[model samples]
Target: MSKTANAGGHEGSAPHLHRLVLFSDAVFAIAITLLAIEIHPPEHWTSIADLFGQMGHKLWAYAVSFAVIGVYWISHRRIFARLRTANGVLDVLNLVVLGLIGLLPLVTELLWEHGGAAAIVYLGLVTAIGFALAALWGYAAFAGELTGPVHRGEALFTLARVAIAPGLMCGLIFFALNHAWGLILLALALGAFIAGGRYMRRQAEQAVEIDQPEEASA
Candidate 1:
């Protein structure tokens, strides 16, 4: 994407892109609300006891998926925050990303009920969503569709980091005869957040280095 300012020297497409961002936000908010409906609180003591016994596993899976989608939304907001404008490609990409994300409830429910290979499949679906998101961010960064001085390195780092958990978890499903491997996947998801946060911090530090020469010269 051309970094040059428009002839009038203002960001060309803010109004349109800003609306897109808001719309995407609304959709995400709705989707997250929907995710909560899948929890199915235990109504009877027997059911409650049974659920509590299995709740640890189901809860962990739900939390993992919940946080996974939440993180993606957070990163996407940051990425789009840099946009100069939105284009047809970006709109389509956004739809695709949201479409994939919209599948989370079904996938989470499948994991909660079936609890073996289905759990792995759910993770695989999430991984696919992550891959699509990474693609979307890469497109925005390279296209200069971002609204600000976005750090491409930081963007790429975030994408790669977000992708690791679901990808690895999908692989672990084969040995997940029970929820054994699913727990492993949850641990990896936590690691992904820790690693991504650290990477983003490093990126921020490097961003400061760009102003060093100007500071020294002054």
Candidate 2:
């Protein structure tokens, strides 16, 4: 049970991480609900098919955006689980990340309304903010060395997982020049990230094992 707060601004009595998680849950719920609102009801039978057909892109955009956001949240949780405490910098960075996440509904709406070009911009913005959060986490972990000596490799692996996002988004943006093909690339990137995370976890475990043996011998 760790307590944290925005040490730079607040009295440091409140737990910032818990607050962030609760706030994040609220925003994500609202954002997801907003996506359903984007679907317009058919005015008549004749327009029903047209409305439904036109919504394909919007639905796809919503699904993709939601999935990416979910992935980021999961990754954030995994990284933070290793920490014994949170610092002001990490709190600020988490706020920034959550702030960007709170904008997902609007961005998703924009992509649904405007299409691929808009999606590229929205995706870039989201990924950049996530990258910043990851950087801040890495910095905090390095600065505090909060995790025990055996857990340093876990920190590095977590950092590597975070680094993959911006790079993947950059590649997807470049490929999205082909529109639908680009969206496919984005999906592929997500798949690759899932696989990469599993691999990194195994590597981290191996590193822990190696370090343990040396420590034992000493």
Candidate 3:
């Protein structure tokens, strides 16, 4: 009787888990699509140079927004990949993450329009998203049933991955204060992201190695 009940419960949770991941994926897709839609070509340009010059900043902003959204989407996928089940609190946190993601396009527009002055808002939004993601991961990790056995190193590394955006953005905030800093901070942010990614990958590899020996001994 207990075995039957356990089996039934697992069956029921499977669909719920699938739906949660699907819904999150849909939100990510829409947010990234909206980013491109926010960019428009110049209405009246005398020449190719004029067209390129006019659209330059918008194009740059679009690229930055696209990359940021793309990274979060990948991170989201990683989080859900380990998840075995979802709870009400997890659902709420997921919604919070999605809500922040949905706002990226508007923030991107703001950054393009007002330049450095608007960067604080943009950075702040990104920072919030980062922290939200970290919180979501933290909750899942704490609730043992929501995920399979999470490796200690992997958990710490995942936290670092989510922290990269907020940490770097906070530093960039100081630079964003000066209008003259312009795209330099954007370039620096991207560079830091790349470096951070490499570091995280190494950490993940080490985590797997650490886990494997323990599992084998067990």
Candidates by TM-score, descending order: 3, 2, 1
* Candidate 2: residue 14 lDDT (0-100): 38
Winner by lDDT: 3
Candidate 2 Cα deviation (angstroms), residue 210: 2.9
- Per-residue lDDT of 196 in model 2: 69
RMSD of each: 4.5, 4.2, 4.8
Please say which candidate is ahead in lDDT: 2 or 3: 3
Question: What's the true lDDT of residue 80 in model 2?
Answer: 64
The runs of at least 3 residues in candidate 1 whose Cα sits more than 4 Å from the true structure, single-residue gaps closed, are 1-12, 42-44, 47-51, 54-58, 144-147, 169-218
TM-score of every model versus the real structure:
0.72, 0.74, 0.77
Residue 108 in model 2: shift from native, Å?
1.3
lDDT of 1 by residue, 106-187 (tens): 8877877887758668767878887887777777676534445556567667668656655565455434545686777757
Candidate 3 regions with alpha-carbon error over 4 angstroms: 1-11, 166-218
lDDT of each: 0.70, 0.67, 0.78
Positional deviation of residue 123's Cα in model 2 after best superposition, in angstroms: 2.4
